[model samples]
Target: MDRPDHDRASAFDADSRRRVQVLVIGGGQAGLAAGYYLRRAGLDFAILDANPAPGGAWQHYWDSLRLFSPAEYSSLPGRPMPHQTGAPYPNARHVAAYLAAYEDRYHLPVHRPVHVTGIERSPDHLTIHTSADTWHAQAVVFATGSWQRPFVPAVPGRELFTGHQLHTTGYRRAADFAGQRVVVVGGGNSGAQIAADLTAVTETRWVTRRPPHFLPDSVDGRALFELATHQVRAHAAGDTHTGVASLGDIVATAPVRAARDSGLLAAHPMFDRLSPTGPVWTDGSTWDCDTIIWCTGFRPDLAATRALEDPRIHLLGYGNWTGPASATLVGVGRTARTAVEQIRTLLG
Candidate 1:
């Protein structure tokens, strides 16, 4: 697919080729966080992001969506999100604006709208090739995050009906589907939120692969923000090597419970088949719908740098780490502070 052209793309010149201590491949929360720590440690690094603006993945969310996390919890290190005229849960635009402001405030050196096409490593440095330019660095951090690509399941006749099929990533607002019968697949947080928002303006149905455990946005006056914090602490303390196992447990207990009790969502069985008309349930039931929103999930796009054996190029830390002169992966921590600390230590 052709990339969006909101920012100018620059060509890589051999004479202009620059060397840095670290190369951050993403400009999202994780990438910026790593940059923050690297800067504090006085390390030479640069951030290359595909988006025209900072705020990372937040810019792709629906228009009416607000973060489940409050402003306080969402703030990055050494900077605070400017408060808007709203409650604790700021909408997607607000979050995006905050990240943009952060980039300006910190003077973060980021190459915007430059898509990274591939990455390779030499004996002493890493080579990052983008659509616009190439970068050479001693270490590269894949802060691209987990949500690199949207996951849409292969269903029969998916292309036939297609009135306006979109993933949660492309969904902007309920008004886009006003007065339409929409069926949203996946009962995760995104699925629930989309269904709930659409319910206010259109007929909606939520289909899931399995019964999801829902939790309230809050529990006993405590937000679920602590979950990320706890995982970061555990990883930093060497008590755990992976954060997914712990995050999965917390998500199961919290958001899963909240969504189930929302009473706005109607849980349908797994999607058994798809036709031009609509999707069929596992029990052989059919529901005619005008639009289908896939909220399945996403995966990291590491094909660009698959040849690298450095710890920096990992898939949840499951890839091979047996390369000469071990290259450390920094900023994999789940929480903001913990991720910053990890970057700090790695840089040191």
Candidate 2:
């Protein structure tokens, strides 16, 4: 099989930072996908991941998180994400296990606990500085998925609110706020699902910049992915189409459906400003809130990449800065392949 196959061990100098043809940053799905293609092309490369374990940010997801897609649809390029015998949709931990196994199965030379500090460009090669050592490479691919950087928008009275404020990153379990009041902000899936989950234990209010759109209960992430694929293909072919779903639309998962049936899926426009007591509406009405769960999303963790002056540094998956599916697990494979081919062309 022409996959990210490995035949020999990674060769590094005694300093543990030796020069290779290419270096891949971030060992999450994106990085792993890049490794697959890079290996198939038989390039000498190494993958560096920051997490001490297999899962990148999957290890830190909220307790109740579930993939909107079933296991078959949620996998990386070569391997189908393994799952529990009866479980249709895999949880975060299941994904974590699959990723760990995928790395081992392919014998991908992944170095762990190597938190990248920065990147520097030299006349001959790019220098990757990590917590461990410095490495030299002729080319670099950035597959660093954007989970480390959580983004919360600026709002009035953000400093005035002394109440507990947490982004979705730090949110673990809903029971922590069992008796409290929460204002879950954002219109995306996380905001919808988290608001729904919080309703089981807390008095929750859902706030969004715009109306939250939900796909039919029969629809899930697979459909979204296919729709996206269609859109990309259509764009390539210069065709216009309609009646497909974007990934941003919420999926009516079991939890979400239950919440909707119980009248918990209602959404309100974003409040005027944040107050110590809660959020205040334009009419100056206030709710007694104790926490604002900002499911506000994240930005691309491209700080180090931006600092480089080289034109050869190509970045994958940090969200569509590259392509339609640049940031997605299933989508990054094609993006990686295209990137590697481009790198080969440049190297020639």
Candidate 3:
């Protein structure tokens, strides 16, 4: 990654430096959620986001894609996402619009196009260096969600291939790959959805390392949200790390089968070997593709704050933080209200 270039000395004078009580890094859903609470408490804070607008990760999704979660469950604090005309799942554009609205509604102070270069702790405060300015604060909250970086597996001859290769972030619409052989890698929701979308205009194949379990949008006399909430609560009580695995297990119990069974999709195991020609399957089968879309998921980037000697930082819930004092990762299909309440208590 490239470090941002900014004339730090010319931007602010010694006495005119901008300072806040708290600095929130990232202006995505998580950051906005935290900002909502902070605003309610009348705390002096500022949010720095890399994107030009709010809604964070949603803005980077494919234009044709819709959220896997319905609008009801997707709204942030202090605002409701508007309904769409189609299925319960709102499309990507709607989500982006909703996020923009959330920022406007709450008047969240988010500085856009400000890439965070580094996070360092001073003797009396934390300094957040961005592309254009440096923010000083008594405390810092990292709301830079888990998807900061895209993971593309390294395959020999990957660059030599003539086909168009893209991570899920760069994917836009099906028209871009019309009439081409497309391979959607990773069995996660993004991979599945991208495969489904491409199939309309091109020959598509879905590949995964492990056969992922799929469930209908609805399950067992209740919505998936209900089940997800129950699981989240259980995890919050004590269990951790098994939340994703547990959700998959529960989804497998449903009578609904894999979406691939509809003849619209083909399932293949992990890519064993790769050549410029195509990816070789474990069974010695070969599949030719003109385009490769990797939706393999993401990892948390704490490199900027690696020097901070805070073990509690890792304990913060995914999307749920017990205020600035405690942390919990609560956003992977879970609500952050309880975590927010906990933070309020600690801060109070």
Candidate 4:
């Protein structure tokens, strides 16, 4: 239920801050999963998302990005991702649409346009401060994902480089660099995909710390999720010898497949340094590049949570730290369920 914007002020004055039993920070995949379990448990929880609307981080992914998993594998706890006829693997738009509907289907009490800035802990509870409102929560969860905090390596001469430089956060399209030379840094799928995208329009170089590990062409994220799950179960049972591919290994999407067919998947080892123009390879050679795109991945956005001393607050959907691959849509359900149960016990 929504109050009029005019009435919201009276609804949430400092002394009248709405208190929730639990507060889930972030409304992305992990946050939604947490909301699902929290609702089923009948917990008085509210999810706060910074995004203006649904779709979480998907809304910000590159235009050509696609999930490596099928619809059935990319769904939330109770809802299956609506199947798209042509997109065997859904793209960013498809995911954003599904998330918007999922929020409605369950009527998850997700508050959007609510950007959490920090948290303050008191003897009995936590106070979550956001851009618009302040929330007093008995228990808090940190599901704020990593995309907001992209990682850029500190290569030598980084400051002196005069060429265009950007992290994947700002990269929009290959056409943006149509006639220029592009250097894509990172060994992961993002690097490979972006490199592939740029190949259509520009001269490209891919530089990685090491040669990227590629999963079998037939294998995709679903298989990796299952493998990760099995590993988690095996670990619980004290079995040590488990082997399966991980998300870090690149999957050959259509563009990547085409790149491979055309012998454009070549990746050079990390350059020794950055020159004013481009990367200088360890071999003392340099490539002239007009732009450098760093797909170097992200760190968990736990800056605020890092200050918490309260065990009542939990963080979900940030890889094995919260649970296995907990950041991914399919992988978040278990973590969220487990976290809610822990919170339930703590509350008891």
Candidate 5:
């Protein structure tokens, strides 16, 4: 992978503060997509990333995690991810490499390890406060994403749990829970996959508020994106139609499929409360488990812009609120492109 062009000297003003027409927060896939269009628009822009290296949140995901779609369907705006041999879906490392290469291929201006503290608005520009330097920009593309703030729903007696508890963020490998009873919470892909991951090495139980929903084995990220896109177009044309939810929650990935075939993927209802040792269902049934992994999901890390209400500041890649399927690799391009065009007109 080509290294990102970190030479940001040209973006600095006379006072040594960096200034640009556009400032993209988060150097992950969403921010990079925004950078691709911003670069093409001939805008003087900079991407401020909090990580010490490339790959955004992908680098932080658990091992054995794979995209639900093949690499060709999971690409950024300018290039397709190189195909992987002997695998239907690329793993997280492959994704990170693709992103880093995309940055180099496009030569996007990316500043790394630069944590953006907050955003301040002036009459004509937005001032970005960062750990390293202050940046002034005509517009800001907030693509920080949700990984920074993992969500765990408030279950009763959660604080009193004596065993280990962690969100999906801290989970790295299934081997970590070997020989122990583990409960994986949530009905999303993460929960299903994590439960699958743990089932082989340990005693595992899957829990959700409702019975888990499973998409057909034929469905993958590609199909899901297409459905979401159709829904978006339908909505724009004043048609209210069912969206991706019509399919189901979790995609039947290889691991999840295997676990299901083995009859180990059966899900239990979410526990009503937690005892010191484990969880207690509404009917007073309890299961003793050594650890709980909450895969509930995430909220957008938009705290930096929480205090400001500026029209020039655009949010991207959080979820449907930003754009349909905007959080996905292939889905973010459309939203980023439109946001850049709007930013260009606003700057002009």
Candidate 6:
């Protein structure tokens, strides 16, 4: 059985520096998936998570956030997520529970609330510096994902806008903006879902660079994952005509579909700049908004990897820059397996 947090902390305190064969960063879906493979490969590895809890970034998501795919389709390697009660697409809490259970089932060595500060690479090994201790490892798997690095595009006169502004990371629920007029910026799934989420509670305007592209209602995350897989295979085979990008951007989830069908989710064109009260268009029209919610996407939290460029260090689950569909739960398993395989070869 795994020791309690206090026992683990005491152990780390006794010896501030430790050695491991491998170190996996960010105990989210990707890191856990990597742990699964590392365990099966008989590698001595430990997962370092910045969060205090087992659920990783999922625990921090908004209450209403749901997976794009069903439970069975959104699972990590070696385990299928348990079906959620009453909901085909599981919510954030259910996902978090499943992840916690996965961690326990595998008995993966995970250190929590241990923030990694930086890493220095030598000719033979990597020295990892964290808030809790120092670790020397033969290799490092960076599965930090992107939740910590939310990206918001710069719009003109943003500083002059006196109203409240927040990224999707800070948004919890629509009721928080109950009586306010809100503008949700971005045209992706997040913006559409959040705009749809707000329609019942307050006035909301969805802004996008172009008209929002809605995938067919029949197309969900499963089909999208298959398409991405096919696209990746095609690219590897030297054929770049896979047509994955041709499929529309947004997944038509239940709420998004309902809002769109009711005409409450209609999107507006991107504004030229921001005014004191709200966003202004090139035509000099402006809508008064009490708050601005940027549903902009995220960048990979890879700051620690900047100081070193070593082949022993591999990155997973940061979107296409690492691998196709790598950031998604179902997609991360393949990437994690590949990463572990490479690590095995290097360690041998």
lDDT of 1 by residue, 6-50 (tens): 232223345877678777778877677667766776778788887
Flag the better candidate by lDDT, 3 or 4: 4
- lDDT score, candidate 5, position 290: 95
Q: Write the residue-wise lDDT of candidate 6 on 244-346 in tens digits.
A: 6677999999999999999999999999999899999999999999999998899889888864467898998988768888989899999899999999999
Which tens-of-lDDT digit does each residue in 1-348 have in candidate 2? 112332233333465557888899888888888888888888888898877677667878998989888888887888887766778888888887787778877788887667788887878888888887798888998877778889999999888897999999999999999999899999888999899989989999999999988888988878877877887888788776532544347888899989988888799999889887889989988887889999999988877775444656878887655877667667778888898888777677
What's the CA RMSD for each of the models?
A: 6.2, 3.6, 6.0, 2.8, 1.9, 1.9
lDDT of each: 0.64, 0.82, 0.64, 0.84, 0.89, 0.89
Candidate 6: clashing pairs of residues? none
lDDT value, candidate 3, whole model:
0.64
Give the lowest summed-lDDT range of ten residues in model 6. Answer: 1-10
Give one digit per residue, the lDDT tens place, for model 3 in 102-130: 76677777777678888777667667788
The RMSD (Cα, Å) of candidate 5 is 1.9
Deviating ranges (above 4 Å) for candidate 5? 1-4, 7-15
- Runs in model 1 deviating more than 4 A are 1-15, 146-148, 160-162, 220-222, 231-263, 312-348
Which runs in model 3 stand beyond 4 Å of their true positions? 1-15, 220-222, 235-261, 311-348
lDDT of 5 by residue, 64-152 (tens): 99998899999999899998888779999889988988888888888877888888887988889988888889899998999999998
| Model 6 lDDT on a 0 to 1 scale | 0.89
Clashes of each: 10, 0, 14, 0, 0, 0
> On a 0 to 1 TM-score scale, where does candidate 1 land against the true structure?
0.79
My TM-score estimates for the predictions, one after another, are 0.79, 0.92, 0.81, 0.93, 0.96, 0.96
Off by over 4 Å in 2: 1-17, 240-248, 307-311
When 2 and 3 are scored with TM-score, the better candidate is 2
